[model samples]
Target chain A: MTRPSPKIGVYGFTGCAGDQLMILNCEDQLVDLFGATEIRSFVMAKSDNHEAELDVALVEGSISTEAQLKHLKDIRERSKVLIAIGTCACWGGPQAMKLGDGKFEERYKKVYGNAKITVSKAIEGQPLDAFVKVDMKIPGCPIDKQEFLKSVSKLVAGKHPYLLKSPVCLECKWKENKCLLLDGKFCAGPLTKGGCGAVCPSHNLPCVGCWGPTDDLNVSAEYDLLKEKGFVPEEIITKIRKFGGSGVMELVKNLEKKEAKK
Target chain B: MMILKMKKEDLPAFLESAKEWGELWGPTTKDGKTSYAKVDSLSQMDLKATRTVIPPKKFLYPPRFTMFDFDEEGFVERTGDVPKRILFGLHPCDVHGILIMDKLFLETYKDPYYAERREKTLLLGHSCIPDDKCMCFATNTDFVAEGFDLFFTDLKMFYLVWVGSSKGHDLVRMRADLFSRNLDKNDILNYTEYRKWKTAQFKAKIDLTGMPDIFELGYNSPIWDELGEKCLSCGQCSMVCPTCNCYNVVDEVDLGTAEGTRDRFWDSCMFREYSVVAGGHNFRDKRADRLRLWYTHKLQAFIGEFGKPACVGCGRCVATCPVDINVATVSTALKEQEVGK
Candidate 1:
């Protein structure tokens, strides 16, 4: 007996819809993707979206508003498995760089000076795991297309997706690219999680840490290396904060704590 | 070993004739970096290049390639289309590196993929000038006698060619007119003088004497943690090193169908996931542990199994590592019990 196709719903929240656009960008595999799964609710892809129970819910963007948070909780209740797709949902993307800085309200006032009424209350951007249980995460500034497809295929087959946890340096070395750090340049390749194929380094550029921090990274070592290279501590932190989000923020904070003890 | 003398000017003609056997590949310099590239003739090659960014192992086991294509029926092994080629300009250290790989891949439990590539490709060794980073002298891989089909030792005006295998003799026979069998006493004296000169050219002093013992004794040393702290875990050293042959295989499935390709890509022990087995238990989770494993395998474990260290001392690690955490530094640190600046 043939089993029915898995019901997958792709949703987007506060950030730029690049992740959703990435799904649409799978034009070549769009037919195969549609044939392989029942896309019950993808508002950007289809007008007729069903808000019913889903086998898999792929959520993009971070929770930055009360409405988005409530909607995410509802989606979590309805979906059997929830996957955070893109850096925004995984680590709150660049938007959540200042999440723990305690300046969200001040920054909000700086951006939009005291607007009277609003459809939803504004809040600091935070990853999906901050509010609800995220089964898996496909991290990137915008998730890699091939990685996204691989994750989807595994999910549809009822298997756990195996993502690489190595840093960008692995991929960079595989590509035979010269290490930017050797040139005394600030490169985040050693600290940033790979699966981006070391795209920036392949072009002779330093990694921007857009995929967030890898687990158990030597953050203090990287900081010290950068500092030794004549980069100021503030400058190094700013560069890391560009796309490092809360994951890297926590690592940097721990590094600071350890340094303080010394 | 059949020794033949060839005039330096006749090299291009000999190489041109050798192309009839297979596609010619030699070290070619581009953008200040030397790498092995397919060349039509000797003129396209940079024979003076001491090393390529990647060694000849890439020809046998590529960085990444599809091992097989799979479908609903079954998996189809990808064996065909491995082109026949003559890889030229390999240094003595690189040739030694290939010999170690041969014992690993072609010996017990032979890897058919590597075997096929090895069978198709012919190794042509060349003499090199030792730079400050070259450490083959310490590893005793500065002079190779066996592994390659042909080894050309450049002695200024003339070339002393050693034909190692029958395949290499066949290439010589194809251009028998260019090679001279007439060896006089002067030629022997010239070769001796050349050997003395080459020996004095080495600048880097690396002593791997009792490396296995040193590695064992320093297993619990705090030096590993210090080295690990400086190591980026980029695996660049592994990639550039001639003997690192670890790889990971993944079965990629197509979106809608139950068919795709099984890809094999280079993996490094420095990577955190290298030791992670099923159930998420990481065997070498700490960077220090991974660093120790890499050095131990190269210096101690391989010596225990093969009676020789795995390191060819090609100096690729010395040149490639960003933070100076290569074999030279690591070995020196172990011996001195202090991390180098």
Candidate 2:
């Protein structure tokens, strides 16, 4: 017998709320999703959101604080499936830049400057999976609607989410845009995942590696491409480390040593 | 392939014939720039402009269209009967832009909204004599010339009208008084010669050969950091492009009520927030990366699949960029980069 509709909950943390807004922006599909499932919670859209057991909990934003970490633990307890929605939850978002800024208190004091940070405290940002096992990640700064819907439908039907294994380069190919990289304009599509349907490229612009690094992406090859384009080691290396940070820094250390050997 | 002649003065009767179907929209003055607007008087149409500041895609895929509205009862599609109209005075680049849209809306997932609008409207393409920035010829997309219903090639005092569709032929029949006797071979030759001269008038050109190879090498290129520093993330390049079609959908609800209207608005990759998903995986987490993505997708990799550059080379990006970062300049820079030694 088909079980009753799975209860789904959507939450947002301290990002631009673009991701949650995007889900609500899926107005047509939102109607169908509501009818198809028991929406246990959605704070951004609806007032009546539950903090109880959920089939799926799509958390957006980074757990940047002790309180947020506790809440993430609770969400993991109640959620059978934890789906990280935006960049913050997936790859620590833009705020992840603070990882290199040393301690949070120093920067926090600098930003707040003797003024009380009476709100929740924060630490360096990290992806949600660092705290709790993320069942699936629908990556985008704000997830693409069509792709999001497909993932949601699949999950609700008790199926594994279909990840976009293709690189941003593939989708850019589909959009038929000019290659900014080819024009000596540095772009990072070659190593980024495809999900945004190559939106940036279609607009006569470049991909910024927003979907984060994909498994199987030829990062070394892309590095070589950027190097050949006459990009400085400082610039290209900085671009690569924006998301991966320490991981990339470590990778670069190895590369530098390898190059030194040559 | 029939060529007919019409005096520049008889443009009124032709527009009047267009009104019999739906609204007649052409390039008109708006916000100190030429934009495609609904027009009645022929005097309001700016036929002399290079291209409209706003794209013709607005007519087909409007930025703020309500795809649907929702309340407790159910969801209701906001479908209005499409009004047949004549979209006239489009430059070659804009015309090419619309054809790309036709491919997008019709050939792909089949957007009913655009298809409905397309079925109702008649496209009238006006050949561009081209200005200093035109590079459609360099991209080899000056014209396959298939998208428009009617094509008008201006030959001095007279207009060479090429009936591109049955609708165009019907339009001519309906407005018979506007035309003189059918044109001979000389008009076609003269128009072709004029087009060739117009292509040559462009001040910039880039050899787009092996762009993928060049781009494949440039992935680690340092040029992005230098150029990205100039990108203010203001999204002006996207806002002005004839073919930049990225968008974000939003829901506008009243304070007291949950009911709302959903609207699709144009969005740009340049926005810091464009890629920030709910859980926060900013794949392109850096300005440099976003900048790189914009250029590579346009000239290098998009060609790997689409068989043509996504850019129509309307130079709207050049015209509108606040920083004056020109693609022509960038492409020339790419040409300068040599492969690995």
Candidate 3:
């Protein structure tokens, strides 16, 4: 008996919708991929999408509204495997920066002076995993297409694909690219996750930690390095929070405290 | 040494013919960044490039090289396959870097991988006009005395070539039509004048007056702490360094098949795991300690072993560092510091 294709759904909440566009950008391979996987729901790609039991759910963007949160819970319940794609979904992106900074309400007023968002109850941005279980995370500003494709294929085959746990420095060294940090340019490559193929460094640019912190992140080393480079604690904290999310920000605080005591 | 002249226009034809010798690697421009790349024709060679972001050391010591392929039966180790390769447009400082690297790799424990490449490769050196960041003159490596097969000095109208080796002599013999033996006393004087002019261009110099003693004495100096504070531990300084030869080897097995390949890639001392041993005993755990080791290795330790510092004064480290950590400035700072008598 011929088995039915895996029911896969694509989604977005509060983001630039760039990650979904990245999937569409795979124009050449999308046709073959569509033939293999049963795309049950994909708002960005098609208007004719139905809510159904999904084998896999590829999610992008941060949850910033009460409506989005309820919808996310529904999707989570329907999907067997939920994959967080992009920095927005994995770590809440730039929208969630203020949540940790303790200036969310003030910034909200600054953007919309006393005006309440009517479409949905406005709430602070949070990653999908904060409310639901995320089986895997494909991290990047706009998730890397190759990595996304690889993860999707592996999940479809019921195989657990082991992603790189190392930092960008590993691939940068492998590419033989000169370090921008050595040139007195601030780079987050040493602490940020690899699998981006060291793209920024290959072009002689610094990594901005868009892919988030590596598993073996030496927080103290990075903090001390930034501090040595004349970056103040506040400035370094801001840099870390850019893509690291609240967890890393907390780790940064701990590292700072240890540094201060020393 | 045989002296010859090749016109500026004839360089392309010469490089095209040089392909008959081996695969050619020279400077090429892409996305506003100029770097050393394999060239098929003269047009691909960016001869006017100041310096590549990373040196041509990758050709000799690649970032990731397969040591050997193995099966379940037994393991086999093989030397580097760097077939007859000619690296053109290398500057004098970089040429000197390879010579210094030779002292380390070719010493008591000869590295078969490096040796295989060294034996098969030919270096073509060129006189460099120093820019603001260049400190080769300070390190006394601006002009190479030896270690290159061919050295080319740019004279206004033509290139004044000096055949430094029998390999270069054979090239001159093989491509006799490309060169002119019509050299006079004026050419020598012109070359000397040009060298002096180029030497005067380098304003940056690392004064070694008491640097050796200063480096030795300043082991416990607070400067190391300051360096550690600013250093990002990115290891880019060593990556761009032509003389640095540190590497790590790992066995990678193909998941589908039982076959595997032992591969070696560039490793940096700045890494936290570089000094980590079994049972997680990290010797150089602190950033300051790692900084001290790097500076001391390049300045003091290398001098003790090779009678010269490991730094070739290519200034790639100084120029590439994101934090503007200038080695020359650091040395000068150390020299000027008043240590406890």
Cα lDDT of model 2 by residue, A1-262, tens digit: 2547888888887567888889889887777778777888898888867789998898998777888898889989998888988777787766675455457777777787877667777777777887789988877877888778777766665555555554565455433344466577777775576668778876767778777765434345456667777888778866766755322444555656765787
- Once superposed on the true structure, which residue ranges of model 3 sit more than 4 Å away at CA? A1-170, A173-187, A200-206, A214-239, A254-262, B76-83, B180-183, B338-341
Off by over 4 Å in 2: A1-262, B254-258, B337-341
Candidates 1 and 3 compared by DockQ, better number: 1
Displacement of the residue B267 alpha carbon in candidate 1, Å: 1.1
Which pairs clash in the backbone of model 1?
Answer: none
What is the DockQ for all candidates, taken in turn?
A: 0.58, 0.03, 0.16
Residue A126, model 2: lDDT of 78
The B-chain TM-score of model 3 reads 0.93
User: Model-by-model lDDT, in order?
Assistant: 0.89, 0.71, 0.78
How good is the docking of model 1, as DockQ?
A: 0.58
Interface RMSD of 1: 1.9
TM-score of chain A of each: 0.96, 0.89, 0.94
Report the C-alpha displacement of residue A33, candidate 2, in angstroms.
27
What tens digits encode model 3's per-residue C-alpha lDDT throughout B1-341? Answer: 77789887887777777778888888887765568888888688777766787787877777778888887688887774567888888998888889977877788788778888888888998777688888887777888868888888889888988898998777667778989999889888998999889878887756765567888888888877766666666677778888888887765544233355777887778777788898989899877788778877888888888788888888887777665555676787677663211
* iRMSD for each candidate structure, in the order shown: 1.9, 13.4, 6.3
Ranking by DockQ: 1, 3, 2
